[model samples]
Target: MRSLVQILAAVKELRWYYWGIIICSLLTAATSLLTPFIIKEATDEVVASLQGRGGGISVVLWLAVALLIADLSNTIISNVGGYLGDVMAARLRTRLSQRYFHKLLTLPQRYYDTALTGTVISRLNRSITETTQFMQSASNNFFPMMLTLVASLAITAWYSPWISVMLLVVFPTYMWLTTLTSKRWQKLEAKKNSHVDIAGGRFAEVIGQIRVVKSFVQEKRELASFSDHYDATIGLTRSQSRYWHSMDAARRGAMNLIFFGIHALIFVRTVQGAFTVGVMVLLIQLVNLAKQPAMMMSYLVDTAQRAIAGSRDYFEVMAEEQERDELADPVVGGRRELAPDEPMIEFRDATFGYEDGVDVVHDVSFAIRQGERVAFVGESGGGKTTLVSLLLGLYQLRSGQVRVAGHSIDQTPAELLRGSVGVVFQDASLFSGSIRENISYAHPGASDAEIEQAAREANAHDFIMGFEQGYDTLIGERGLKLSGGQKQRIAVARAMLKDAPILVLDEATSALDSKSERLVQQGLDRLMKGRTSVIIAHRLSTIASVDRIVTLKDGQVDEIGTPEELARSGGIYAELLALQSGSKQDRKKLKNFDITA
Candidate 1:
């Protein structure tokens, strides 16, 4: 097992509290050592005065003073340790959030693409809480207890060397035995942590896709599956409790056996008459005090080991390599603009594969000339979005290359590429803020005039102004309060605000009503007037004026040309147009259904 040292090193920001928590615990240990000495003095002094030496009052009074001092020491030390413990706990929780939250955002899209949102949520919640709790549990009672235990054993030896030797052997043996017994539980906690994440993620996904789940009528099955996992989690928790109880039961038995051993040693020493009755009483008190520390030391070790286990989980996450921004010496980034005289977009025999190794896209070649509108038309299983993703440099190609403005995306800085392009995705995300805030999300400092103009271009300004609060009204999550067309237009307004040199529209107008769609399409037409635009259009008429159409089938480019040229060529593009032109709900509608499959 790796030590918790590596995990502890992660809190660069809270180093002072980490050390403070430990040092204060040691102070408590020092206060505790006074306990046995106080008892010993009080016992012997009273015994001597009662027997012969009758300075009884003063001697007894002196013993009382020593005890009072011990109590004061304990109260002060314990409180200080407690304060430090709270400090450590508070800082640790803040640090966990800082580390994990930033890491969550930086992780590649593919990581989330395969994970369950619930599982990530559970980890974020439970894992972070467990880690923070470890800070308190390891420091507060646990630390002070361990120090007191070892110190008490040493003090016992100073009083009676032989008795101290016996205690020393017993403590280690008891710990070894208990540790061996509880092995099952440590492994169980780790396994439970992993399973919970998977289960949580599954539940989150099921809930997020509730509409689909209901469409498929899998509610009963989903609930049953979750119930089984919930039961398993409960079973594991009980098993862990049982193991600890059994270990504790055995430890109590060991404590009793040690006391018996002490009594037997004292009986042999009684013949000397060197130690008084009072000394015997004092020995009993010292031994009991010593026993508690030993028991507590074992508990401290348990707390530490458990923390180490929990820390192991936190370390696992921090250990996964982060995707660092590789932009080096060249301060300039990949700026999106038209080349002197060439295509604005180019894929030179590109190849890319996801973590699944399914080869979602393979060797492909295509180009979109400057000031041209290019539509990627495809049937089901075709890589329309994937192709755009490559052009955007989101997923670096495994082989070949992609270039924008005749500059290689692989070689260009990500910041520059991001700054150059404006995109309106199929699932446009809206913030839970005012309409003004949501539209200006990409460019927070956009002027009011620029924002209003962008809204007008998106054909959303009129509806937005009709609201009582105008642009200040909140949209809520995913814009649920707004109509579908409003949300889509809001998204279009956001993209328009960016005013990037390159524009991307993936089913941008799919959610809008016919009238709104026409208005927004006109806004889009103006946005695309001179810029290089890549569009994924389901409507046949929308792409009629585009410079070229690239037809895709099963991840391969089947044809590329103007609508007239492709129609004349009698290729896949022509067939798709023929179907789309027949009815509003024609073969084109069937093609849209296949995209998700």
Candidate 2:
């Protein structure tokens, strides 16, 4: 119940509809109570005086007609209220979903470091679906049941105090059974969702690495793993069903017992004419009417418990405090005006990490002026990648200052920073879209002419033209249809399209062959003409053309100088060059060098 309140608070924007849903359900409960009087009148007064009062039949018929109209009206209004509840749920679901996506995109890179890709995906999908179900169920049923239960109890006590006491006693017993059992149901619901999430993760992993699985001939093993998860989810679901059904059975049996007990007490009261015949019949009809609200209340319990349980988990992700975007002063408008002809980037004694307890990049500082290409080369566990991530605003600096385009990185707006810095990650990240869309991603509204120009600058235009549909050709998932170098070139073209003043080249050309590498080298040299470029490279052979090389070893600057100058020092960089360049440099070794270059 506490969790349900929290989830409902998220959709508080549609308060009127929420109230409307409750009110309509109360109306249904009210109308149901009135029908009992009509039944009693027909049974006692009209039948007893069939030939005595000429108006007796007319009175009974009119009341019957009134009851019919009331029931019909109640049904219509309830359906309308249900429809409104659905609409409200849909609207909130959409808003929450969009927010969830932007949250992922803007979240610190460290969040992804420990978060599994499939776990994130499951929350984005199943968690949101359950949340929407909660909103619908709560508005359509939960609140209404509470209203029905209260209204019925009040009216019941007003009509026949003794019999109403019976309902009061039985109702609580039924409620206690349902609620006590719901605790176990809630646990199973969460476990059920967890199992599904694991299944989804394994499915994504298997599909992604199908080729590897095939080569290893482990298809049967993967299928068995998936089947086990499915069965676990199914088992939990069955248990959840039985838990609720037991409550339903107990509730129905209790209602029947209450009805018999009330009627027997009423017959005894009517013996001395203390209660008229019509009144006795009315009590009987009312006795059944009394259960309407109780039954609705029970249904509401079932729906609300399930919805709220699922919603609690969903809100866990949605309610995560977002990273603060507080800036001293936020900049606005296009990034064009702030572009520097000979831009300079400076990191002044910066210290930062992905989490609070441990720092990854310690008191580090560097400066790069326009047209000066600098590379950060290091072993795998060093801080080279961390440095690049910090520069890209994927992680905030814990201390010191990072300035881009002569302005403080902290003072710069995140949107503005995103527009200004162009990066190509080592994995050659690409989405499912046309080749043209992939290039023009940073600036979505870029024209075809701008896109073609950028592609040509990245030396990808010629190859793109060779595709059957040219720029319109669709790339498969992760650009799997394209070769490694092809994907890298497309990613390069995307950065080129951004046309930012500063570029972070994190091994952007590492996957290319000698000829393709040479072609891209000329394009990159031209593109870096007046921009501050920071490169994270592993191939010592490739840094010869760069203006300067800064080697990272064990999280500190091992050597900082030109490739030739650093080689003369006989440090980590020199040793790496010696190991990489042999009489026959392993092509595979060179491939990894290119990958991390």
Candidate 3:
């Protein structure tokens, strides 16, 4: 019921169109009712003329003409009303689709952390399609069906109250039976939807990582798993269908029996002279008209239930809390300038975690001066990436504050804060597009010359120029067509084009081959110049040139000093370095610490 109200409220802005449909339906109902009365008059006129007491065939001819006109008018009004309903349905679809997409955009990153991309997309498609179709069906058919039923009942009651009462029983009984099964049907549908969503999510994941699946020889297993979900849906559908049709059959049988009595009542009344033959014909036609809505009751209820289910799912996502935009200040034009003495990035006693009471980074305090290159080295899952995420304002700290350019992160707009930082992750994460689009992503308005200049600085221009289309060359999904080195270089060029005041190199060259690493590192070097750079790398050699290195251990700041100072202090940094040294002496030294080389 709540979902139905929400669906109605969603399309309230187009009430004028709805009103037009209502008017057309009313006219159609009135015109349709005229047909039975006209037929009765024509029958009576023919009978009177045949009995030699009529005003001849002229009256019947005129009634025939009137019937034709009513039929034509009914057709036109119904068509016009259908067209209006179609337009309204389409508009509702557009309105709801745009709102859903906008909500997806405004949602926080944390929402995506546990959301499946395929499931999210599936919800949008299924919910909107079902809702729109139901709306269209209701507008085009439901109102007319209802109006015809009501008018038929009133006319039938005027002739004989018993027939009208019997017709009324048909509808309420059918509806009650439908209402009994609707809950169970909807539950089954929801369960089926779960299976389908999971399958869809897995389908997308498999397609996205087809190479992994193939390489692992799990193609058969994946195919079987995918088929299993559909099989489960089929099973649920069988039960759902059986339950619905069984109840529908029972409703229909009861309706048929009542209608049988209605037909008998009309016939017997005419035979007993209580009703004229013409009146009997009119009542029979009215009964047939009323039967239309009664028979259609089940279908309408089915559509309503599907729509309610879909709307409930759609509104569930919309009801999710969106990121608060009012709390952060807006960015003006370009990046804000920072004073030379100001720390470009600051984290004071920062603590954070993905889950409550499980802090990933604890009591971590640090400051990076403008243009200073700092590196963070730690074991896997030691909160290295989490810190960078916090710094970039991707996640809020638990108890402490992080500031960028003297503005607290919590008070700064995410876009404004992120606009001041350029990051090159381990994965290039490039979309499928032309080289020009990928390179100009960070600065879409960049000129050809500016794009080339950034690419050249990243050592990508030469390789890109070698292609037939140069910057126009198409790179497939995630830059699968390019070598690891080429992709990283493009990412570096992107960061370079951004020209933000701060840079973060998160294992930027970790995945590249030695030769590719050299090329990408050259680009990283030029990109990092004059920026407050935060580096996270497992390779100690990569950070050898950093001004300072902060070592993290078990979610705490284990050491913070110059690279040389931390190396000699024999903490997590020295242990990591010794492990990477690959010498017998370094391997023997690992025994002194709680680590293995």
Q: Which one is best on lDDT?
A: 3
How close is every model to the real structure, measured as TM-score? Answer: 0.87, 0.87, 0.92
> What's the CA RMSD for each of the models?
3.4, 3.5, 3.1
Indicate the worst ten consecutive residues by lDDT in candidate 2: 588-597
lDDT of 2 by residue, 235-324 (tens): 888888887787688877887788788889889888967676778877766665556656766666766766676666666766666555
Query: For candidate 1, lDDT tens digit of each residue in 1-597?
Result: 354666567677778876776687777787676766666676766767777865678777877887788779888878887887888788777877778888876666677666677877887777667666766876776667767767766766766888777777777777787778657767887777777777798888887678789999999999888888777878897988788777777876787787789877766565567466555655666676667756665566566556666676666666666554756424333354454886778888887788758777777899887778898888756888888777776676788889887878777766677677888876667878899998998899999998899999888999999999998988876676788778877888888888777898888776667987887788788788778899887677677788888888778788888888998777777776666567866754656523431
| Winner on lDDT (1 vs 2) | 1
Cα-based lDDT at residue 404, candidate 2 = 76
Per-residue lDDT of 165 in model 2: 88
Ranked by lDDT from best down, the candidates are: 3, 1, 2
- Runs of candidate 2 exceeding 4 Å displacement: 48-51, 54-61, 141-149, 234-256, 267-281, 296-299, 328-343, 351-360, 397-401, 406-411, 585-597
For candidate 3, the lDDT comes to: 0.87
Query: For candidate 1, which ten residues in a row score worst on lDDT?
Result: 328-337
Off by over 4 Å in 1: 1-3, 48-70, 210-219, 238-244, 263-286, 297-309, 321-325, 329-343, 356-358, 369-371, 445-453, 583-597
Each prediction's whole-model lDDT (CA):
0.75, 0.74, 0.87
Off by over 4 Å in 3: 55-58, 328-341, 584-597
